[model samples]
Target chain A: MATIETPKSQYGQIADLLISRIQDGTYPPGSSLPSEDKLADALKVSRVTINRAVGLLRLSGYVKVKRGSGTIVRTLPVILRDAKARYAARMQGTGAGEVEARQHNLVSNTVYRQIAEVPAPEHVAQTLDLKPGDPTLLRSRTLFANNEPTQIADSYIPAAIAKLSPELRNENAGPGGSYGRLSDIGHGPARFTEDVTVRMPTEQEQQILELEAAQPVFQIWHVAFDAKNKPVEVAKHVMPGHLWQLHYGWDE
Target chain B: MATIETPKSQYGQIADLLISRIQDGTYPPGSSLPSEDKLADALKVSRVTINRAVGLLRLSGYVKVKRGSGTIVRTLPVILRDAKARYAARMQGTGAGEVEARQHNLVSNTVYRQIAEVPAPEHVAQTLDLKPGDPTLLRSRTLFANNEPTQIADSYIPAAIAKLSPELRNENAGPGGSYGRLSDIGHGPARFTEDVTVRMPTEQEQQILELEAAQPVFQIWHVAFDAKNKPVEVAKHVMPGHLWQLHYGWDE
Candidate 1:
């Protein structure tokens, strides 16, 4: 009987080589990788090892394998949230999506926009200290990164405050977005709290983001408070997990 | 014609009531909730509304609705990471699992432990400043929180330093754990960098974590540096995404 080589180390090495190639742009995003037989022969490894390596790449969100279509490199758009930039003096004046677009040299567009007056949902009411069913202005938009739908944000603002600022009701909330309009109305955000969680995308979310069934989504619930520590705005953002990675850093 | 109410608001209200019930312990973990007909009659909502509400809860990881079985409340084991506690003086002395157990008032156990000398994988090698295939000590453990598997951690240390400290090889590192033993041997951690991402679990990972097919996992790669800023240890932790929520906070 032949002795079997350790699978962990061998497969890990193969995966590393493939990842390096992917990182160096040898196989750019949307480009298909070589077949398993070709990789196994070139690397002098068994087909099983090649399969395992590809599997590792799939699990790492580096590549997507399709039945009868071969494997393709994944396009990963990272969103680096520098702790300093997030709370920067200037950033406090603009929306996060606008800042992300400027940093990445990409165009940010509002694909879908809807401004409506509706009953506040329970969570939103609690966050904004409004009675349930109270009238609130709902500004819903689908934000596009480089013309691709990347995130959906739904912002809720008190009807009294929103009605005072006509710009807040427009599709484009001027240059600095809602915060800029809020500042003009003496309700600028002084503090923010964000809660993040990950889960499988809902059917509606998958359709909006055009994601595969297996893809997950990141949900961020953000509440902005005024100088008095009273909540002024609450926004919920849903982003495709496979296409986005959030970066956070802090000094010890 | 009698007007039909909008489904969105009605369903959302129903879901909110159900979530409130779940939160207040009206329906405890692992206990089945009432059927759709019963819920609709009691809550004065349509059956369609109940179905949609239950579906929302299922997607949010609040309850699990099996095919043949009814919907049951999910047991959410929260591991809250306070910013101050994470960087606390004493936490710097112990393992993350130990600190998590203490904070949550739950018992933590090391269910699996293995210490081996193996060739360093490429990523581990790069982080540890070692050549690929260099000898390294791999310490693997599966941690359980209150008798339930919570996380799998794999730590790699240079073989040279690991050989100098015998306590590092033991299943239970005395006192403050591996860092303490490393300090005794002249290699204590000073700084750390952690990168976190989420993805679908592999077959092996699913089995180890005992997760469902749709469940995702969070991967945290940590590199620890010494006083000289040289990497001394690299660790990878895999936690169930549905069971964990990472918290980060900072003041401007």
Candidate 2:
């Protein structure tokens, strides 16, 4: 049998080897890799080559350098959010996120950081079908999973509806969350759309989510529409990539 | 009205201001930003402050320093893949990705890079409910959007099924592509689960997608199930984050 190397560069080959080790559990998640010098010595490669390989591994989300910890492998998330089950739960006028958190054996809490009627941002105004500078109820929340901040979601609602419902401006929304309160106010959401993207966390997002270096975030723009097809609410959620993955299932 | 500054650091505040300019269309997508010195002079800040602010902006996906283009605002994606629509299209024996590219006035193309029977990886084997090292037919393709590499998708099919279907081994899978061929072979897909996560691209992925610096990739593991709920096919798609976003719609 003949073994032929492909078009990969020398550093690329080294990175692939390191990745296989991680995948095969040699360098399990949350475990630190050996020092670059050790790896270079073992692989008979220069320090520069090992450095490039580690850089690739870092970018590939296999390992990240922590403040106090060395190059630790990324941890696998335990909390898995299924879009289908969450839809069913939310449709029943329940706190779907909290329910899922509980199912994962994690305590879920929503900390209302800010609840105020303010002029909407330009994009938010357009999304909510309001003129720029029109007043909107902004609910800022820090969602905690297992007592740690997991997500920062800022929800925007039309000022009229929010003003009508008192909980929309308070710390607790009583029975269900904000969605439940909205249903009681004749604006029950019938359909939802979640547009998901990814980017490196901003400075503020890093502070809020307590994300580490090289961690990206899932930037989800979620919109809820009433039965009349009118946009009822718009929320932007920023969650750490290491802690989250979005799953969607559909029957063919 | 009196104004009290928030707890944001100096560079953070500057990044926010610059973000506002980008949002307001002052620094439109794909447009190069002013020099660091010029921006510092205009914003009345030191060059170091501007550099830090720009660093934040770069991470946040507002802008990136292209090799020759300098700091250019990230371009908005013209192609939007609605998961629901794609699900329906695939269910009906069609290539949803190609349909979407056509809708966006872009030329969609699939370049088959490799097609062979290989031992399934441990993860792929587990996902497909097969024993480790079992033979699987691998179909590696590079999907092009508007004649540019947009995704590198590697699909794995059980050896038994692939060998039975002749077209599966060929670049041209007759009408409707591989999914259609699978349906014709009585192993039709009945349902699908797409698990999506984001990470920085590997060296190979970066080269294949022709991605710029600091660009992330969406790694989606799509599993197709038969009517009996048995996993039939497993595919791992690596798409440039800037070029794609997954949207899901549901009734709630």
Q: All candidates' lDDT scores?
A: 0.74, 0.80
Put down candidate 1 lDDT per residue, A135-230, tens digits, no spaces. Answer: 899888787777767888888999988888998878768866787788788887777766667876655676676665457777877787777787
- Give the runs in model 2 whose Cα sits over 4 Å from its true position: A1-78, A90-95, A212-214, B1-78, B87-95, B212-214
For candidate 1, give the docking quality class from DockQ. Answer: incorrect
Compose the digit string of candidate 2's lDDT tens values, residues B82-160. 8768756765656777877877777778888888899999999999989999999998888887677778888999998
Best by lDDT: 2
Give the CAPRI class of candidate 2: acceptable
Which 10 successive residues of model 2 chain A have the least lDDT summed? A1-10
Residue-level lDDT of model 2, residues A1-252, one tens digit each, is 112223777888899899899889999978999999999999999999999889877766677678788999866444677866775676565676686787767778877777888899998999999999999998888888766677888899999888878887776676667878888989988888888888776656767776653477888898999999999899998887757778887777
Q: Tell me, by DockQ, which candidate is best.
A: 2
- Clashing residue pairs, backbone N/CA/C < 3 A, model 2: none
